[model samples]
Target: MTRRILENSKVLITGGAGFIGSNLTETLLNQNNQVTVLDNFSTGKMENLLPFFSRKNFRLIVGDIRDLDRCREAVQGQEYVLHEAALGSVPRSVKDPMTTTAVNVLGFVNMLYAAQKAGVKRFVYAASSSTYGDSVSLPKVEEQIGRPLSPYAITKYTNELYAENFHALYGIDTVGLRYFNVFGRRQDPDGVYAAVIPKFVKSLLEHKSPTINGDGSFSRDFTYVENVVLANQLALLAEAPEAVNQVYNIASGERMTLNELFFCLRDNLAAFDLEIGKVNPVYGPVRAGDIPHSQACIEKAKARLGYAPVFDVRSGLREATKWYFENL
Candidate 1:
């Protein structure tokens, strides 16, 4: 935590108008770093980029990563690239695999090629927990992986492979953070592919019951956005040779069942509106392509990238609830 932070330099964040990318944009802007955002506004929101519009250090290109020219334009003179653009959602991929692969896999190579050709110092991208697909390991480690259960998982694993190839062949420094179930502010809760936490919080705020996609026994290692922002910053500046061209599990190193997550969100929301306490979760059949449980062994990130997540599950839920109470 004591190393230098990214500042006074140029940075490009693809999908910078999305939840995690916007947070990263905000943090770097505060440091006075010149930040450029390239987004197609497909899944990313214009509202997330609204706060940064007036900042002098902020630049936005209304473009898609699937476009090689746009990717090249976004990476020009950039010292680092944070690739966060993708169509995320297992069920969504199940329904439509073609669009997902086009964006996640094809779009990823476009960005990486652009960054490599630009001679960017570091290429830090958002990898996924879904890459550890079908593996029954309690706490997921980087080395072990199983067959992908969904197209979304396949796309993410493809990202890791491409990143490795780019580093070995082209010598562009790269780091992939296999993010867990990340949740926090500015996350859109209205979409069909919305994350569970924000969607559940929105439902409770509206005094409606949220549906848990399974029997509520399935668990995940939910990470806060701030921790992810920190990880990206560290990965961008990490000088360790072992850290580059590698993927690390970025999480709180904790796990909570869906039933537990429901109650936690309920309890936190009830603090503002007492009626939220009465809202319960309705049970549904297990979701397709979802693992039974997931947790992260974060020792690799801790040792290599100096990653230490400051927000645990309840605390992150508390902050997220507060934001939802005020905004939604």
Candidate 2:
């Protein structure tokens, strides 16, 4: 017999066509769980989920999570709700704070309210590593969150707050996973707001110079997408009542600098006999609302949710690089 989460669950994932959401959809469907994905296609693409378009257990809704009726409809009869829809990018958010706030905060509240009213078994959301904003801590723990630096970071922190309030007032089981720099397949490499890994990998593959946003000393805990999936699975399945209404750091529990990541990507591309272009990264001033360093402890997730991230940066990058080579 399969686990309850696998056997009888109908999961709803907002933004299910984006990089992390699409990967999570693939994982859940593989686990024998029914998955309903609601995406607006603003950043999410149908190509990201083209492989699963024919699966009976998978359903797709082309809608925005910001809409109350859509949110309510998506939450109806769902066992677990994984809210991943949001405008993500510090620089982009800094440029247009209103759009970020509307999507990340207002959309989050709409989803939470809808899920709570629908009586979903658990509500888990994608928080960000940016929540540890100005804290100069080396390895960030869940309990010690600093002031948010960017509009995006503030919105993520706001998600945690809304989740906690919903859990407390409405008896909704909510867990927030503060994800670090998640990277892997299906990540958009063309957008100006694309993440670091995909952007660098795409640039390197295209024989272009990858731009470093700041001095190379800035570091991050670049978590893989698989670890995030595992964290969400645990958040949905964990039976401990104490785990409700809390936040957990979802990461690989390691750290690497941007310069280090650049070289690593270069080397991986080189392995394919793809002549690595000159590693001349154009330097720019540090962008606003960006933290200098970030690393997650992940002990809370380990002890509470049994979240064991299987892949570190190197293993994850190898797989990601292979995917980029094959797909891009």
- Residue 223's lDDT in candidate 1: 94
Per-residue lDDT tens digits for candidate 2, residues 98-177, read: 99999999999999999989989888999998998898877998888788888899999988888877777889988999
Q: Ten residues in a row with the worst lDDT in model 2?
A: 1-10
Alpha carbon lDDT of each predicted model: 0.93, 0.88
Q: Name every residue pair that clashes in candidate 2.
A: none
Displacement of the residue 299 alpha carbon in candidate 2, Å:
0.8
Candidate 1 local Cα displacement, residue 313, angstroms: 1.0
The whole-model C-alpha lDDT of candidate 2 against the native structure comes to 0.88
lDDT of 1 by residue, 184-278 (tens): 99999998999999899889989999999879999999998888999999898888788788999999999999999999999988888899899
